[model samples]
Target: MRYLAAYGGENNVKAGMLHYFMYPSNDISVMPKEFLEERNATNHSNIGEKTLKKSIDIYWELYKVKGRLQ
Candidate 1:
């Protein structure tokens, strides 16, 4: 949590927390639809597709869950 937020902009902290909690395997799939939608719309450039991909990888590793994050 702290590591991911280390390089994040101050204003992005809230979004980062939401991102971590909303990641797949949290058993809250439908809950974060709006957050994901908003994030895709707003942070595409800031976080970028590559970063999101990396996030997916990290999520899998962190939770030890299988399947795709997309």
Candidate 2:
């Protein structure tokens, strides 16, 4: 919990940064330029409540899958 404080603001709750973290290292060279442009264009604050609900569903699925891995 203390570590999450470093990211600040809603970042601790935001899935966008988590998607980046789970992506293969920060090797922009490996990612397509168009994908990078799209990532940069994302406006998290403007995201609708439905998206957040979907994210929660994804989080639960990921949690279940991760538990199965062990």
Candidate 3:
């Protein structure tokens, strides 16, 4: 979390957090639909999509969840 916030803009990081909520924070899916609608709005360019995608690709092998940060 620290590393992500340090590298990814904090706001975008939160967006990612919500996107990956299935990890544990997935309860966010229950939030108002209006909020969930923002899911496609985040773009954490500083976090490097290449690296982020790689990490997620690996994690996706073990866990099947939905949502994209950008």
RMSD of each: 13.8, 9.2, 13.5
* Candidate 1 local lDDT, 24-60, one digit each (tens): 3323333355665655423213565567656656653
Scored by CA lDDT, what does every candidate get?
0.45, 0.45, 0.46
* Per-prediction TM-score: 0.31, 0.28, 0.28
Q: What order do candidates take by TM-score, descending?
A: 1, 3, 2
lDDT string for model 2 (3-52, tens) is: 12433444443443444434424342234567766665333334555675
- Show model 1 residue runs off by greater than 4 Å: 1-29, 32-45, 66-70
What lDDT score is found at residue 42 in candidate 3? 36
**Best by the TM-score measure:** 1
Which one wins by lDDT: 1 or 3?
A: 3
Candidate numbers sorted by lDDT from highest down:
3, 1, 2
Candidate 2 clashes between residue pairs 3 or more apart in a chain or in different chains: none
Angstrom error of the Cα, residue 29, model 3: value is: 11
State the lDDT at 37 in candidate 1: 62
